[model samples]
Target: MASTPRSVWHNPVHFLAFGLGSGAAPRAPGTFGTVAAVVIYLLLPVSNPLLYSAILLLSFAVGVWLCGKTARDIGVHDHGGIVWDEFVGYWLTMLMAPPGWFWIVVGFLLFRFFDIIKPWPIRWLDRHVHGGLGIMIDDVLAGLFALVCLQLLAAVI
Candidate 1:
């Protein structure tokens, strides 16, 4: 595995792209980043889907730049440690999610599952895409997939 960049600590863009430093974990950085995202989810006012959607849109937009710049600076395309995508992905998974720690945990697991498994077009896009947008698109899809599943589960149970 590549070394975690020191710039992650000192550079603001790298820091943010690294999921506020959670991505710097020695192993399972994406998981750590998603965990960090869980904290962000807790602080957000997710009762309003409009507000949550706005936040997801802004985060996705900003994450492209943040992830792109950090990858370029570090000379790695979609470095495992650049995990702002995970943050946005997890938040997307929780869109309109039921209010409770149970939902939060479920969202976390679902997002992580799809992210790691990279099902269908997600795997294809992850391989075909490049740059900052490349870094984000797969997780974005994973989040979307997880979102659909979670919403369905919510409706059923």
Candidate 2:
């Protein structure tokens, strides 16, 4: 049930298992976790332009550092169990947009797809960047990708 700390560094399964654990929930843990973060994000009065801007900015800055630190502490790089990038990504994706369940579902799918597919620069960043910021950067790119797609869909629909 538990991975041994001694071998965690060398064990690929342990690292992948730890990272992907976030997706293992009976339901959508990544979506659930992201939505939970949305509640906190919305509670901040970001409905105001200034405050919303701050939350977006601060979350990103903190995300880079915090996610990296957590990854290091866990002895893995961008482990799936660490979904803080999802937290920040969803927070930014939903900002200045409709908060309906439909939008939430759209955001969730887009984020996951982009994260997994890792197109263009997202793939490039994930491969080239190192450390915690590297981990967070790829997700940030995924979030941005989702944001752009969601915005386009909103326009068409």
**Residues 1-157 of candidate 1: C-alpha lDDT, one tens digit per residue:** 6889999999999999999999999999999999999999999989888988999999999999999999999999999999999999999999999999999999999999999999999999999999999999999999999999999999999
What is the clash count for each candidate, in the order shown? 0, 4
Q: Can you write out model 2's per-residue Cα lDDT over 41-153, one digit (the tens) per residue?
A: 55767568688878778877876776677567666776555566777777667666665778877887888888778899899998999876786788788888888889888
RMSD of 2: 5.9
Give each model's whole-structure lDDT.
0.95, 0.68
Model 1: residue 9 alpha-carbon error in angstroms:
0.6
Displacement of residue 50 (Cα, Å) in model 1 is 1.0
**TM-score leader:** 1
**Alpha-carbon RMSD, each predicted model:** 0.6, 5.9
For model 2, name the residue pairs that clash.
19-79, 19-80, 19-81, 68-132
**What C-alpha lDDT, on a 0 to 100 scale, does residue 102 get in candidate 1?**
96
How well does candidate 2 score on lDDT at residue 27?
56
